[model samples]
Target: MPDFITLTGARENNLKNVDLRIPKGRLTVFTGVSGSGKSSLVFDTIAVESQRQLNETYPSFVRNRLPRFERPHIESLTDLSPAVVVDQRPVGGHARSTVGTMTDIQAVLRVLFSRYGTPSAGPATAYSFNDPSGMCPECDGLGRTVRPDWDRILDPARSLAGGAVRFPPFAAGTWHGQTYTNTTRLDVHKPVGAFTAEERAFLLRGRGARVRVGNTGGSRDIDYEGLADRFERLYLKRDLSALSRRTRDLVREFLTDDVCPVCRGARLNAAALATRVCGLSLADCARMQVTDLIAVLRRIDDPVAAPVARAAVDGLERIEAIGLGYLSLDRETATLSGGEGQRLKTVRHLGSSLSGLTYVFDEPSAGLHPRDVGRLGELLLRLRDRGNTVLVVEHDPDLIALADHVVDMGPGAGAGGGHVVFEGTPGALAASGTLTGRCLRRRATVKRRVRRATGGLWVKGASLHNLREVTVEFPTGVLTAVTGVAGSGKSTLTGELTAAHPDAVIVDQSAIAVSGRSTPATHLGVMDAVRRLFARSTGTSPALFSFNSAGACGGCEGRGVIVTDLAFMDPVTTVCPDCAGRRFQDEVLRLTVRGASIADVLDMGPEQALDFFGDLDVPEDAVLRPLRALRDVGLTHLALGRPLSTLSGGERQRIKLATRLHRTGAVYVLDEPTTGLHLADVGALLALLDRLVDAGNTVVVVEHHLDVVRHADWVIDLGPGGGRDGGEVIFEGTPRQMLTVQGSATAEHLRRTTV
Candidate 1:
């Protein structure tokens, strides 16, 4: 067997004639700023090849049903093992996918209750929330019920015939809206508030009352429920996250929140809930923070229940060890912060004994406080010591120190990045003076003297789960870093701050819109400007330049690709042969701006487009000015027309930042904006932050990048340790003062970087 996995002349994107051999069963970190070939080397080359080869083992029929993996270009490989890449992609599940189902520790909980409990249950099935046998009759398995926002439904002051309901799909005089007002069989001129109790109930909360309507479109039969009731049944409490932004907003306007009457938020039936080993229901155990849950499970004394419960306890312990004990089991998967979601996945693999496996992670220390970095390092080491190859694409110096070997990828990012500039032991790379090395060797102390806040937004007695009686004030102007290990209540704090400053234009990477039509252009609102430019280029109507409105190829209807779901076969998405993957008509493509077509303009990277459009006099609209500012924030490497789905997490965050730059009094709160950024881009990002402050905005960032933290006007460092060991603010000061204050994880990290 080969001693290592070998790659020969691999030419993945941005990778320059790369040849390297990674040692077996070691924690090898791919470093060298963002834009370096680290991700290309670890994820694109090694992990993809291993997964692709493993997929080839099945028969043709079976393979056809799986996600097709095209072979990566490479000469050969030796002693390769099946690879599992637990990337940081959001475990975005519906209301159904939860911690109880994800870790299967919930399965053990079911078994524990079924086997031994205060009251005998039917079987394991009797203890499952998903089981009809054990499920609450009212809410099915979901713990909440959606209701309509009644206030949005009717203008009680307006008369029935005077267009009282204003919501879309139920506009005044529309079939649905007119029926409610016209067929109360009451006078159309009377204000609703002056009507009898029966009229009031029928308008807002009564059950379906069949009625007849006559209008411009003619007569129609209508089953009329209160407008509020119908809206509630359709939108609230349901998982509407997948809908378009307009749909989400419209639904939100008409929806109200409610708890499930049957489940009472328990999400389980009486049999399952009653059967508990230690008087704690399965739901009760899951509701406990994983760390606290582990302690409860260890107290079980019954021999018959010991082994099964032990497995469940061990699983929960894994969660605590990886630094995610603050997360409650009943928490919505969709609501999890990205960094919390990533570590939650890592926690599952800690006790795993699987060997000869290749594990890939994206910035595991992201969103972590400096103190929590040590705990994250422990988990990564545990996986490596288990005889697995742990490959991480990272920027944190603390994690970098744990690597047995390090491969530095670039001198820059985008067009200027992707070359292998250095590779050796972590110690060697630290001394070699690469961008990463130079940064690692320097530290910026917090200013001994501090500026008085232009203003202060205070969160008082803010108790949002795990956060106990916390009160703090955030500076209203200038850059501030909320430094805490993952699950340190930073999100809770931000949530409180934004609520107090309702008009503060909140810019979070989490809330960035996701859709099939969304791209860097749409996300930054630059598509409108591009359309106008196209209209002027050929003197054609602007409709010809819009894919949503017109100018799409007839064959594919402007989708750029024909999507025919194979039903049984895995979905295949091939480039549209008719449009040649170009997405626009030939006539539309012929229109030129400065001798380049609109398609050509989109194809240009941000850097190249900067020079092209710099002198072309683009509009001063919200979109164009922000697009230019996006290019300024080191996004020049990104393509204007690139699909948002194609951008990495870091790229998406930066793109979100560019869009927020134009907002006045905007509170730009980014979560680890430095993720996937090259060391070269850090300076540019800092400049952008400075620009935002200068533009009369307040910027608060939840970050782990040392450079960003050291330069902050203020830092709130959380965690004396992680999970139960962590919670309160351990240190709060400027970066320089923070470094001298011993025992703070942030301080220790700043100290190392200084030396």
Candidate 2:
């Protein structure tokens, strides 16, 4: 077998014909600034080629059903193994999916309960909430009930004829509204508030009354349904996924969700809930923390249940080992953060006996505190020691230090990046003159002088989630760092802060919704100005410059690529034959703004675009504002036309911050602004936050990075631990003062990193 996996002449994305050999059966860390082609080389190129080649070995029938991996722009990849990519994308599952179901531990528990419970539940299926026999009939096993918000739906001050129905779909003058207005069951002229008790009941709850509704064509008698009943039937009784996103959002405005009364949020039928093992029901086991659950399972030594119990204990131990001991099996997968979801995905492979596979992790240390990062590092080493090649695209210094081999991908980002600036042991890279090396060698210190608070934003009695009715005050007009371990109440406290101050601007790490057609130009609201500029220069309609409109390439229909589905084969996507990959018609591409075509302009990085528009004398507040914001947020390397989906979590978060930069004297709440950022980039982010504060704004960030904590004017540390052990404020003071504080994990980590 070859000692290394070799790639010759790769040019994916910003890569410039890069070639390298990654050692097999060892841990290799890829390091670079954001958008410097680390992800392009590691994930888009190497992982894609490995998976694509592996997919070819399966039967054609099966291969066609699997996910299609497009061939990377690389020449000759050799000695590749089957690759498993654990990306930062959310572990998206329906409401029925939970930690137990996702990890398959719930299945074993179900079997144990079915066979050993005092009162048997027939079979394993009978213990499953997803199964009809075991499901809560009231909620269909979802554990939550959606009901109409009467206050949001009804305007009692107005009569039916005077627009009493607040829901847009049934507002006055609409067909649905006509039923209530024309019905003889209640007074149309009198205010709904003035109605008698019977009249109000009949208007809201009564049914089967005959009413006449008319359009210009004709009038006809129809059976009238009560307002509440009609709303429930049309919006609540059916699958909301089938509705358009806009419709679903509108419906949600008039609806609220709560625990189902029948299930009481357990999601199980009476028989299933009644079944217990060792005096604890299946739901009870699921609700216990993984760390606690392991002890519960270890006690079950009954010969018949031992194997299943052992299997569950093994899986639960892996979860606890990965520093997720606080998470319960019943926790909803949808509620997990990107980092939490990524770690959970890693858990399944930990128990696998498969060898000679390549495991690729995208920022495994992303959401972890410095203390937990060592645990993640150990996990990576374990994977490497199991005769598998482990590759990580990471920005954390600690994770990089754990690498047996390091490949630093840049001297700068975007057009300036792609070449291997340094490839050696971590010790050598630290001494080298590369950007990553300089960042590693530089020591961060706490702020010498902290800013005084202009006022206080108080969050009192914040008892949500894992919080313990804690009251805290966030100082206004200064930068505050909310530090905590994973599963702590930092997110919950931030939620309360935002709820208390609804006008605050929030820039979170949630993925930006994007499609093949979505780009930075569209997302930052600059596409219209760019289009208008092009149209005015050529004296054509603005639509003529839009790829989604008249200017769309006939061959690709604005997608820039033609996807061909082949029966029993991998679907292929190729650049359009008509307009190349410009996404616009030939004539549209011909139109230029100061010698640069629309496609050419979109292809420019933010810095390049800013320069191009600056030379054209575009108004600063109009087109230049957003471009400057992007550049200020350290995203100068990002191409305007690049799909938002292709960007990293840090880049996306920065993009969100850039869009909201114009606000002044406003409170800004940011969640993990440094996610996916290089060490050097964190400096830039800190500078930006300082600018926000200097310009008279209050900024509070939920972060785990010690540098952010060190630089913060005030630090609010939550948790000496996570979950139940970590809701109270352990320390609240300046970073310098936190160094002397005891028991805080954040404080300890901060002290360790301080020079």
Best by lDDT: 2
Candidate 1 lDDT over residue span 1-755, tens digit each: 56788888776667767778888898888886555567777787788778777777878777777775544545665577888887777788988777757767788888888887778778888877787888887778777776555566667788767766667777767767766766655666888668898777667776656778777877887776776666656665356876777898887676665788877888888767777667788788778887787888898878998898899888887777666777667777777766777888887777677777888998887666666788889888888888888888887777898999888877876556667788788888878878888866664554455445698778888777556677887887878888766666676677777888787656675656666666777677777777886687678887887666678777777667777666433345667887787788888777787788766777787667667767665766644576687777767777777767655667777777776667777777766777767555677788888788877888888777788877788888766655555557777778777877866666777787653
Worst 10 residues of 2 by lDDT: 614-623
Per-residue CA lDDT of candidate 2, range 1-755, in tens? 99999999999878889989999999999998988889999899999988888888999889978888888999889999999999988997878889999889899889889878878978999989999989999998989998899888888798889988999999889989898899988889898889999998888788877999998889999998888888888887787756777898999999999999997889999999998888998889989988888998899989998998999999999998898999999999988999999999999899999999999999999889888999999999999999999999998988999999999998888788888899999999999999999999998889999999999999999899889989999999899999999988898899899999999998887666677788888998898888888878889999988889999999999888899987756678898999889899988888888788899998898888878998774667767999989989998888898878777677888898899996789999999989999999999999999999999999999999899999999999999789877888888899999999988888888888898
List the candidate 2 regions with Cα displacement exceeding 4 Å: 149-165, 169-246, 615-620
Question: Candidate 2, 541: how far from true, in Å?
Answer: 1.2
* Model 2, global lDDT: 0.90
List residue ranges in candidate 1 displaced over 4 A: 8-20, 71-79, 155-161, 173-238, 261-263, 448-450, 514-517, 547-549, 553-581, 615-617, 664-666, 719-731, 740-743
RMSD of each: 4.0, 3.6
lDDT values for all models: 0.74, 0.90
